[model samples]
Target chain A: MPPVLQIIDLKDSQATRSYLTKQTLRSWLLTTDHKRVGLLYLYTIIVFFAVAASAAAVMRLNLLTPRGDLVQAETYNKLFTMHGVLMVWFFLIPSIPSVLGNFLLPLMLGARDLAFPKLNLLSWYIFVFGGGIALYALLIGGVDTGWTFYTPYSSTYSNSHVALMAAGVFVAGFSSILTGLNFIVTTHKLRAPGLTWFRLRLFVWSLYATSVILVLATPVLAMTLTLMALERIWKVGVFDPALGGDPLLFQHLFWFYSHPAVYIMILPGMGVVSELIAAFSRKRVFGYTFVAFSSLAIALLGFLVWGHHMFVSSQSVFAGVIFSFLSFLVAIPSAIKVFNWTATLYRGSISLDTPMLYAIGFIGLFTIGGMTGLFLATLAVDVHVHDTYFVIAHFHYIMVGGMVMAFMGGLHFWWPKISGRMYPELLGKMTAIVTFLGFNLTFFPQFILGYLGMPRRYHAYPEQFQVYNVLSTAGASILGLGYVLPLCYLIWSCCYGKPAGNNPWGAKGFEWETTSPPPSENFEKPPVQTEEAYAYPVPSSEPITE
Target chain B: MNARAILYEQFSDLEQQRESSLAGIWAFIASEIMFFGGLFLAFTVYRLNYTQAFNEASQHLNLVLATLNTAVLLTSALTMALAAASNKMGWKYSTLLLLMVTTLLGALFLAIKGIEYIEDWHKGLFPGSAFAWTGSDPGHVQLFFVLYFLMTGFHALHLMIGMGLILVMLLLTWKGWINSRHFMPLDVTSIYWHFVDLVWIFLFPLLYLLGAKI
Candidate 1:
């Protein structure tokens, strides 16, 4: 046998004694083990993703015709609301952080587990409980207040399950806060010996930045939702303009958290892409400090740009100009990340693996999403496309295109380590191609629709926009297929795929130092980091062998 | 080996574990500050926008009861601190006693707060459309009462959670699970208790004292 297969067999035997194979279902449920908790988050988030994607499917089908044909106008409203709520809170926000972050942080940092392991378990329970309540609300008659829950309609007019949904979100916000707190403390206090701040991987840096946003911004969301719930339940005028409450006050409080929330969704993806770029390109990341600091810069600058979302909400032009300027400034850090990743790949031994494909896709799509954002930030352009499909297209590009692509890339890249098996490479690459193509086909036309003066959130539309709607629907089906492929193949790989030894991709990180599906305590002993992260070889066609 | 020396299989030593636990609590407190910070920001904006109405509405609060509740919470913080200090000193009996005192004081604050809520309800200070505030700008005044009830209600919920945590600590102390070196549960709980107290300190001044001189 070859040396790699010999190593694979040796590690495979050890992996059978992993946290997963040794535990019963009851033990798994009650586990304080970070790996088990990470799996728990993974399974739960997939369920939420299915629900949200189904909602998206229905919305796409409904939009297929110029006249609304599939669902009633009210049902369509609830459909989009459910899609927004489930996707934003249940899926995207926690996607990489809870699942990959929980699993990898300790492994990457060489810690045994997170700082507060029990708190880690509790955060999962809190998330499930909150998601349960929200799901229950959806079953009982859904909330139609658009996930934004903008005032007067949410507080006074709408007679749906606004309070229940808000309560669910309010409770879920705590889960985010606790998770953030755990990550922050672990990153600060639990690094292995000799693992100084600058020696950390960029993924760890991005997790740290994401955690800062999670810790600080999520609480504001909790408070804002609490007030919204109170207003809905008590018939108070906190947001009702007719009752002398300022509607703008609600907008200010909501966006203050929501804008930072976009970063909470994408920062982890950026971190994942950094890992993918370094490993596949077989080079140390170019301008490591710039990329690391850009994560922090994004987190800090994210807070100031919330005003950009409120540009047309009766906000002063002066405030709009300031917000527009800050919004443009926030894009610089994101641009820095894109540039750094490209520079890292320049003339390097680049491998077009599945994960690298996704990373490259993320760069292109995020650039487009981010640049269109500048258009929205421009005072006059925003006035034109304020509530149009352009806004819808812009966010989907960032969220679905940028973040989701990176999420898939990270998941595929880390799957061997996570599940102790190598997924089929050809299948993985095919799915990546399908996802990118389908995602673009689905959203790219919305830009044209918006530019042609088609507004969003309407159940019915004029006949002129039918071609774009049809194309978007067609793309949705393909995207849906693309997403389903991984769900099926990944599960199959988990059970039957070839065993993946440690460091299948020959990544130069501490996490790759351990066996695939590392034991419950992670490393057999504490690992002391002695080298800079991503210390890949210069122009090596093959990964270095021990 | 001592039962408490399990070290949780994660940390290298007891000291590292204890420090990590303390850091976790402090990080949680930092999040709590932002949680309450949002409400405070809203209050500041509304207060500036509707100064006279807020002050006039604030005057309707039962000052004596709120002030008494403030003292109760402050006393609870003291007892909580004493409990943690005693645990660190290996004084088991004194730790238990201080913990009980802290829990009782927290409960006392809640009791007073409940009475004040009932009084406000009777005085028609609720924020419904038919609220009976016969003052200038009833709408903005209603806004004040809305904020008052919301902030205080959330604070009470937090106190209840704190009380529950104290009860857990009490049980653990009685069972001998927590002692001098194993006092992390109590220590972290005390940090949380003090956070509850700190939130009240701000709420007292913002909600009760804003209208005093006006």
Candidate 2:
């Protein structure tokens, strides 16, 4: 047998013993284990998925017959806003890094727990508390402020439970800040012996970059929201246009945090796709340091591009020009990542597994999504596309199409360890296929509809838009089935699926070197660093980096 | 024979774990700087935008109380830092005493802040309904006060939270949960306390010292 297989067999035998014990499960749930805390975050975000998806369902329902047939146009507006708010803050931004990054970061680096376990758990609770409040706010009528929570409308004009929903978003913002702080502190202080700066995983580097955005970007968001809430309650003139305040200032402040927030959403997806691509291709990622720094580069450049979102919204033309040029520059690092992933696949033994399929879906959709964004970035193009379904189609491609695809890829990639059993592979592939087809069906035609000058947030569109609406609504149904199928079987797999042997997929990482389900401690003894990340077939000599 | 011996022997890694937490808290304090740094960046940008409005709005603030609040917060930071340092120097009582003083001063800042707010309310300087600014283009001037209330209001909220935490530290110290040898509490508390001070260091210039005539 091969040397790597020998090691794999050894871990499988060990996992068999641990699986029979009750202590591991109890230790995971009640204890202050950072790994366990990460798992808890994973569990909570699925609930976010269920809630956010329902909001999307309502959005699709409203558009089915058009002309305000199914739900009132006002109901339609509320539906989309709720969908945007729940998904962006709750699911996409926090999903990969907070849940998976928190789970895998310390373990991959061989730390015992995070530098602060209590703080780790506290961040999770804060996240759940935030989600609960937002859910409740939605239950009691709804907040009419778009997820962006724009000024004058959010502050003074439209009163649809503004305080409750704003408060919910406020709490959620703190959770993002706290989690980012914990990850930064952990990466700084908690690496295992000899896990030097250069020797770290690309995923860890991406996570560190992400946390910086979270800590810095999220607080500004929190303060911005607080100012809005106060203006709503205290009737402050800070952003009230009638009171001589520039409501545009609120737009400037909001997109300041929000534009970087998209990076916060997508950077982790970028990180997850890195692991997925490398693992599936069975090769060391090309230009490793460049790929790592590119994550940091995207994060840095992301902050400079917020004004592009406001180009047609009365921002100074000089600011618009700066933001426009920077927007083009930001795409360079993202292109570098795509180039490296493609290079990793060159002359490699790539497989078509469930995770890899989703990874491929992420790449294709993310590219199309990214390309469409350039149209919105250009001054002339933006004038034509602004506030149109072209805008909606453009972002949903990146967010729902791109980020959500990577999110599922990650869920399946890490599930064997997270749950102590194997998910049915055939069933997994079906969902993956459905998700891809359904996603494309739903959003692709909307791009054309948008370019044809159909405005978004309209309950009754011109008869010309009906064809596109029919396509979108039809796609949503398949997408809904794609989403629901996994929830059923993945849960069923938890109790009765085949036992996942340790290292079910032949991979070379310390996480794979552990049990199928890790022990309560995650490692029996402190894992010593011995190999560089993503070096396939287990190199016998000359470990890369430090 | 003593609690120290038992703490070390029983857990076997208690001291190691506590030191890790102390390290963690200091790292968290660093993150806090960067977090507040973002707001400071925003303030810097807008301060550049409407300099006259910013200065005129600062004038509406009572400088006496602002100066007094600055002194009080600075003194509290000093006490809090000394509290952490004294624990390292093996002075448990001094550490506890400094913490107590820090708590007292934090409360004093809130008290002075409340009084200033009341004075502003009477002067019709609040941002919203019943705002008064004697100038041409009073609207942008009102924006300055809106920002003033927001920036200072946020700082005040952080102060209140810090006060609550310090109270918890006081009770722990009194309960003998804190000591010279096991002083992670003192260290973490000091980092937070100093952060509150640093916030004021920026707030002092931005809110009170900027655009002052005398």
Candidate 3:
């Protein structure tokens, strides 16, 4: 009766098994399986994380003395630049979405895989190729321009590898775009029967929002960087002031992508925390619709406030005022997420498990980060502390304290599902706590030093700022330990830790309904989602069964 | 239809597979729009700042050749549409013929564009040190040519990619891989081709015709 006959190959999937069983390098290198691709991203980004963190470590240690002891001024500039570029593009942007989203999206949606599985694999290849090019730039001679790649200096004067690094980011930008495209199409066309928009998990909602931002915003960065690279190579007047070009134009175009890029960095972490909150608290998210729409709202409103970053760049006063107001408005959606997450936690079965501990850390630190963001959004206040350490401290809180916390928590929460083994629960909890303390120690003093007018991007500072810098350096060592422990034990758990069954935490989601590692086609049969996501506190009389 | 013949493992049925491909291509198109949108924004700002110089630069572009190329490209779109329609009707030979015709038309457009580029190069319309503009506001005029080359160069790159894809589709069609029962790849390729065509449609009026009368 249908126009075209449709057939379901039931027998083919009857033999479905673990995707990880194929243990050849070639299988992984050429595989289109989403789960394997997810692992590929996981392994790749971890390498990037270590490199970027090491750069941060060296910089923090160098800041310990007022005399800029560790590296030259030029070298320090390159260190921070490399740190920001590698971490933002290589690690944070791809962390949750590429690894966890690639793994869980299909499982949650009850689809076999993403809409374009080959595109997913291709994105990973492009990511690695681009990352290789970028790291190669660092190995040869590094670009001194910060990740912002502001013009005139970068376009006309900088002697370092600006064009090469821009080329790397440009290539990687396509990877981000493709990944976003895959997620958006998968969410749209691949949902299982009975899974409506409102019925999807909060994590999926957040990724969808993140994907929209990725799809729309990243290409502008690609084009902007292309122009920047071209200008550098050709010595054109595009961003060079000497040839009658305006530098502000570069800032405008850069922030247009970069500001939304800030959201691209954080929204998935918010998604992960939403899942952590619901799983730990044993309750439905209090305002599910509000939380869902707020993700979309953040993605949309993020575009309008890019001008906030251009406030002190000699933009018009009226434009600054508009950008300032728009920047404040983003807090509405962000606060909605924080408040809704907290409300979901209130009076519930609160367990301070490792994932939940990281989730709690996310809430506190993100609140601090978000609140400080308001201070920077205030026009006069920003003028006073524009490029100061306070600004550095503010973003580090959001990026490191907030997003990194959420990333760790999500990794812990999904560890059982991801690896089919439990990470040592006690060790996990301790790392989460240490990371929290170390993060505060590391960044909290910078807020004070910033308010005291010590600028960023400087290797040396006044003696009054030395005490805080020392504390921050001490904290960096501890934080490094916190990061390293999980890397060691998570690998150990994969081989030797007790085998975790499908639903370790009694987590309520379609992903939990399958085998621990999940089959190549995700589910044995297409799952029909009948209840809404986070249908928590199911009566104890009826147990959840695999 | 052989159930396993055309369907990918990830999809349950043919309809879902086709729908997914359609949705995926449209999403890619939306991204491409934003990609070009940035270049267009640059053009708008600079044109607003240096109107007379931009007008002077615009005059240097070979309008007759560009107009001929536009016609050639628009005809290629028509032939591309016919190829898709012929494949749908299961007319194998006409599909192949129309595809070849479309590819040729696209080649002709590129040829005209190449000729124009050569003409511009002879005139020293290139943006760097060899630029030979003696007009007032030479700096901004040089800026105009810089954008002119970047925008058109990027467009040509995309068009080349489109042609490569179509060539592959042509091969696939000859091998009976993209027949009526499984034409999603060809359909999506046409979508991309049209998107590139559509971008040129906008680029034509904005770049080549800006202040032509004034």
Give the share of true interchain contacts found in each model: 0.82, 0.33, 0.79
What pairs collide in candidate 3? Answer: A390-A450
Grade the docking of candidate 1. medium
What tier of docking accuracy does candidate 3 attain? medium
lDDT of each: 0.90, 0.79, 0.90
Model 3 over residues A1-546: C-alpha lDDT tens digits?
A: 122311333222322356777789999999999999999999999999999999999999899999988899999999999999999999999999999999999999999999889999999999999999999999998989998999988988888999899989999999999999999989988899999999999999999999999999999999999998888888778878788788899999999999999999999999999999999999889899999999999999999999888779999999999999999999999999999998988777888899999999999999999999999999999999999999999999999998999999999999888877899999999999999999999999999999999999998988988999999999999999999999999999988777677788888999998877777877867899999989986434555589
- Write model 2 residue lDDT over A156-188, tens digit each, in one string: 988687777888888888788778877887787
Model 3 C-alpha lDDT per residue in residues B1-214, reported as the tens digit of each score:
3212388888888898898899889889999999999999999999998888899889888888888888989989998998998888788789999889888988888888999999999999998988988868889999998999998888999999999999999998888888888888889989898988998998888888975763
- Segments in model 1 whose C-alpha atoms lie over 4 Å from true places: A1-12, A540-546, B1-6
For candidate 1, lDDT tens digit of each residue in A1-546? 235645455655664667777757889888988888999999999999999999999999999998889999999999999999999999999999999999999888999899889989999999999999999999999999899999888988897999899988888888899899899988988899999999899999999999999998999988888787777777777777887778898898999999999999999999999999999988889999999999999999998988888878999999999999999998889989999999999868888999999999999999999999999999999999999999999999999998899999999999998888899899999999999999999999999999999998888899999999999999999999889999999999988888888789988988888778787778867889888988776774566679
The TM-score, computed over Cα atoms with residue i paired to residue i, of candidate 3 is: 0.96
Better model by lDDT: candidate 1 vs candidate 3: 3
Residue A110 CA displacement from its true place in model 2, Å: 1.5
**TM-score for chain A, candidates 1 onward in order:** 0.97, 0.93, 0.96
Once fitted onto the true fold, the runs of candidate 3 whose alpha carbons sit more than 4 angstroms away are A1-16, A538-546, B1-5
Chain B structural similarity (TM-score) per candidate: 0.95, 0.86, 0.96
Error of 1 at A142 (Å): 1.6
RMSD of each: 3.2, 4.5, 5.0
